[model samples]
Target: MILRLTLAAIAFAATLAAPLRAEIAIQEVTSPGGIKAWLVEDHNIPFMALEIRFRGGTSLDQPGKRGAVNLMTATLEEGAGDLDAQGFAAARDGLAARIGFGANSDEVSISVQALSENRAEAMDLLRLALTEPRFDAEAVERVKGQILAGLRADERDPSAIAARLARARSYGDHPYGSAGDGTTDSVTALTRDDVLAAWQGAMARDRVYVAAAGDITADELGLLLDKLLSDLPETGWPLPPPATLNTAGGLFVEPFPGPQSVVLFGHGGIAFDDPDFFAASLLNDILGGGRFSARLMSEVRDKRGLTYGIGTGLSVRDLSAEWMGQFQASNDKVAEAITVVRAEWARMAAGEITETDLATAKTYMTGAYPLRFDGNDAIANILVGMQMLGLPSDYPKTRNDKVNAVTLDDLKRVAARLLKPDDLFFTVVGQPEGLTSSE
Candidate 1:
């Protein structure tokens, strides 16, 4: 099955590379009720993929109710209207439709895929789930239990511990600092009323972004949007204030019994719409943005075998932005790895980059763009994300041009302005030799 999926993905990528890149068009559609969406019409396939994102997400959780939004979103499809949890699942399965609801710190997303023949039925089911989710006590407890179990598991996960601690230190008391899944105690304390209120506070029309692809016309998509989402509240809870990173350059060490220590290090990042974003992106690509040729991988892993891998990239969120990286190494070597990382960070901050690095990063980024638009589902998801990021519809066509336009001078300028070795904070989880907490 894995091999089959791999081949299917390759074929889909090939299709996108051939004619789709040149011919794909995005149309803006506004429903009669004034809700807007981006549509990509493709009649070649009889199925449509619709993606919707609500911006407030778990960040809108009421004070002392950290996990309410997450728990509420998870229970959305569990039961709604006349359908109980089991009945809802049965009805959805009966039509061979796919529907999913999920939430993270920044957004709550819903994705649905349905054949044109059964599209109406599928939409109706989705409408029921969104507009009239039945937060029955039984279903609520079941889902809450699952979330609690996950939280328990996360407590023992070294990576999860590092991430939670890093965010907590970075954002302080802001909502972004808290775990989206909440703590075991928070989930346990949740009541059904809290769940219902979370639905009201997080899911609403005003904060929604929509994208649709395949077997759907603008008019049809507009109508579907109204039918599925018109009943939601006009607005959700007020948005959270932007969060600022509070941790200055330093190391925070949490002692744990393990041979390997996980390190999370980062500093502030640029916004998505910044003019120098492309340059910053190329800089990151050359530094540690997933490619094996990245400086971090080549220097840390290939040259010295400090760890199996290492990477860094920009994380742009609605309320905050960060440039972060992570890697794990044996306790005996973690201090050396940190020394190497600090040297690289200082080097990059001093604008030590070459024309060769710029050209290579740009070529790889531009060449890999089309591979991301492999199918209707992928495209739809990308469209909604673009909308959320305030990108113009023509971004897809001009994105590579933007990447190609970055000059060696541009990269150095942005690197000097953006990279902050002095502001980088490290959160290390596990006992390591010769390292002390800067805190």
Candidate 2:
């Protein structure tokens, strides 16, 4: 009860605080052991959120050991050092701290929040979880059961089926192609050793990036970094190579008996660091930016009533990206819906956007940008993310300018380079009447 109240207070405080301005300074600090982190110091509320991200997340899984890293990450809080799972939870609650561990294709992330009064104890607890995760047999088995259950559920989910099929077809034999959670056979066969190996391969100093917001100083953060991370191994496993994308265009249908078919479509996308990325973003917005006003939603859902929602995005990975989108329509309407999408895709490929379209997208993107920094925790994550993306500290100040700088010609250039209608592929999952597998 006390822990809940403390956390609620932090949330409440964030609500009362003013939105962070772009001119706010981000200080980069390095620890005694040479580990570096970004800091945004706000001493107002006696609370702080610390985020640690280790690059090369589940992509570092060893051959035949898929899901080991994911399972290891889940078990970090199960037990550590002299503490059991129950003990760890009790200790964290006692400190009024919230600590979480997560993993995705590109990184493993650790988040910690604590009040100023109990910060040292919270850090010590986190240090144990990182350095000495027990991964005991009982705990590992329980967590494995949970993962297996989720995998079974994924089999029945239409959206998951479409996404999995798309990944398999688009990125054959790459880490990107396979499920992050191991298949039933692979996960069932996993032993305790694999979990420990995954721990060593994933959680290490070399790949770590850190960020903090609120109630902390650079000097104090330097000491905390060493105290928290110094005991871990210096390096982890090598990151996987870039995905070899199959950019070929086709419509492949997987027959699942459902009233509606879930469609996933895309081809190659621009790189994250590309100079024209801002233009690509604007183009995607005009085409299908998950908003009701975007072209795809306007054409397919609003006018045609084929589906409730249809949206698109750039699925950017470490060294790869794909222009991706998803939508659902009844089995009968799937063909018409897809036809309309392809028409819109081809239309965008021809650099057919208006001045008004460009201006509205720019206004929306630039206007909504500052609201992202709504609270200290969000700002902390943004700081870490900017560093990971190789963005400068002053990026917040310049981002609106960058968004507003793209002229019509630049958008057209990106549209010409990207938006390949011939290369677009669709993975449709359901028993639709007209769609079929094509090459």
Candidate 3:
């Protein structure tokens, strides 16, 4: 009784001590041509970093064109405006500017950085890539060959195969189930028109949300944005509908010719906008997000001595997300490791988190939040991400409060919603002893 009271007191104290504060300040402005953006001006550095995210990403791939978006993104840098692949690379190297573009499962992002004195030229270059990408036939062929080579190489990696199998089994026919990079067949069939159409969707100003940080003012940034994006075709973007999670039953095994076995397990998880997202985040940390302090490390590695290390994460996809817990161990112990994982997952769902466990998870999440903004590039990237996700401008500031708000009850609820062992599509990609095929 006395111990129970002490624990209760501690929990109450933690709730009071580390409250979350979900405040992020954003300054919105309209470009001269009516293009809008969210800004957080900081004139501290002598460089400016800009990140623009398009509403749709890989999920926009049409049927039979599974790698269309991926190929388009890869092709964008091959040539743009008047610069062929080599020429584009030369110009980037000459300016000493770092420019990169990528597409994820849900959004396409372009990151550009240049010296403040050269913002005009940099923006001009960025605008050209965004608008008048050359997409030379030769460059497209080169990128396609490279992608096919990588896919073939990846087929030999057991860990990669395991991850692919996990998502494939979980999502089934969903776009997330397919490879982000196009397959040999898909890439071979891709045409120049398809790339152009994908590009058209990505460059729309309304569908684009630009975030700039570092050495630039709102007014100057606005003008630059106008100068860069004004000439682009005004085709409005229609984001692909969000993906839904499917937690159908049965384990999935991808037999591979390897010594060690890779295992992945989890089911439908929290969405970013779920009010219980903070609770889910805290739960993930206590369970596996913390490599050092998580239950997975302590039980799976320290006590059982099965694997070197294990970690889990809750990924917030373009709209929906999944909680995937993954690890690798010797083939002999694969079954045992899986058993322990399922048990712990059930335990978490049964409200097994103690006050101390909750406090520790919250502390880690809250304290580590600010580390995401340690550099100008990181800040610029996050600011754009926040906008894309429709999070409040003050999200960074108030993040801790939301994390602290997670109660034991909230954790239990989210855990139950997320941890579906029977429904979990476990994929093992190595030759595990005594592991029967679950296909």
Candidate 4:
């Protein structure tokens, strides 16, 4: 059954490729209550996908109330208005609607899908979730237990440890360094009042970005927007201050009971709006973002047999950005792997890429771009993400051209400016030999 469903989804996606490639005409919609959204009308499907994003997600958690926002988001769909958890779930299931909410470091996102015939009822359900979430005490405790269980599991995970350590080292005292799920102790300490405060602070109209796709017209979407979000506060919480990278380059190893080491490495990266962002992206692709074809994969895995897989990419965040990479290797081979990685970094900085490298990277990037617009939900999510990154509306049309326009000189210049082998920091977890923390 899963395989059959997968094939059907793939066929549906293929049907959308042609129309999507022709340019989806996005309409700027304004509700009667003054809320705004981006709408892509497509009557071919009977359902619509709605994506709403609010900036200052978990980062807006009060200093001592670290996990409150995350917990609140989890409980939004658990119950709302006059319904208990099971009651809400049954009502939503009866309508065959889907609604989800989640919080990360930069944003709180809500996703909804409902058929045109049941959209009005679905919107009311969504409105209830947003404006009148019960966050019942029993539900809160249940969700908190689930979160605590995950936190405990992460404590035993080498990859999770390395990731947490990397952010802690990179961002220092900033909220970005803290885990979005909060610590077990912090979560255990949360009260119902804390959850309510987090909900109030994180869900507001001022920071909201909305995008809708599928069977929805502009006028209808505008009215739906007012119905769903007009009750949210005009302004909720102030965003956290920008984080400065505090990393000092060197290997930082945490001893774990494993023969293999998980390594996370990176340096500062270009912002999304920078003119040379696409060049840096292509450079990253050739160096490590191209999966099997990346230089790191070719040199480290294919040639040296040091690790199973290695890859890197740019991370453009709301308040900060970095070029990051990760890989796992046998304890004895980790030193060699790091040596090879640094060599590749230095070689790229020295401009050793060939025309074939540029061509392959461009082809992969451009060809893969269209596949992301395959489904209405995917398109809606991308539209909201583009807004979050401050991208222009024509970005969808011009994105591939920007990728294709990158010249060898552009890659060379960007590589020289952005690649800093000496500044690279490594956070290694496991019993890796011959590696020591500089600090």
Candidate 2 vs candidate 4, TM-score winner: 2
Task: Give the backbone clash total of model 2.
Answer: 0
Measured with C-alpha atoms, the lDDT of residue 383 in candidate 3 is: 85
Q: With candidate 2 superimposed using the best TM-score fit, by how many Å does residue 299's alpha carbon deviate from the native?
A: 0.4
Top TM-score prediction, candidate number? 2
**Model-by-model lDDT, in order?**
0.89, 0.90, 0.76, 0.89
Q: For each candidate in turn, give its C-alpha RMSD to the true structure in angstroms.
A: 2.8, 1.0, 9.7, 2.4
lDDT of 1 at 242: 90
Kindly indicate the candidate among 1 and 3 with the higher lDDT. Answer: 1
* Model with the higher lDDT, candidate 3 or 4: 4
Against the true structure, candidate 4 has what lDDT? 0.89
How well does candidate 3 score on lDDT at residue 359?
86
Judged by lDDT relative to the true structure, which candidate is superior, 2 or 4? 2
Q: Residues 1-439, candidate 1: write the lDDT tens digits.
A: 4433543454355346434452369999999989999998888767778999999889998988889999999999888999999999988877767899999988999998776777899999999999999999999999999999899998899999999999899998999898888988888999999999999989888899999988889999999999999999998999999997784799999988899999999989989989999999999999999899998898899999999999998999998889999999999989999888888988987988999998889888988887777678888999999999999998898899899998998988898999888888999999989999999
TM-score-wise, the better of 3 and 4 is 4
TM-score of each predicted structure versus truth: 0.96, 0.98, 0.90, 0.96
lDDT per residue for candidate 2 within 145-239, as digits (tens), equals 99999999999999988988998999988888978787888899889999999999998888999999889999999999999999899988998
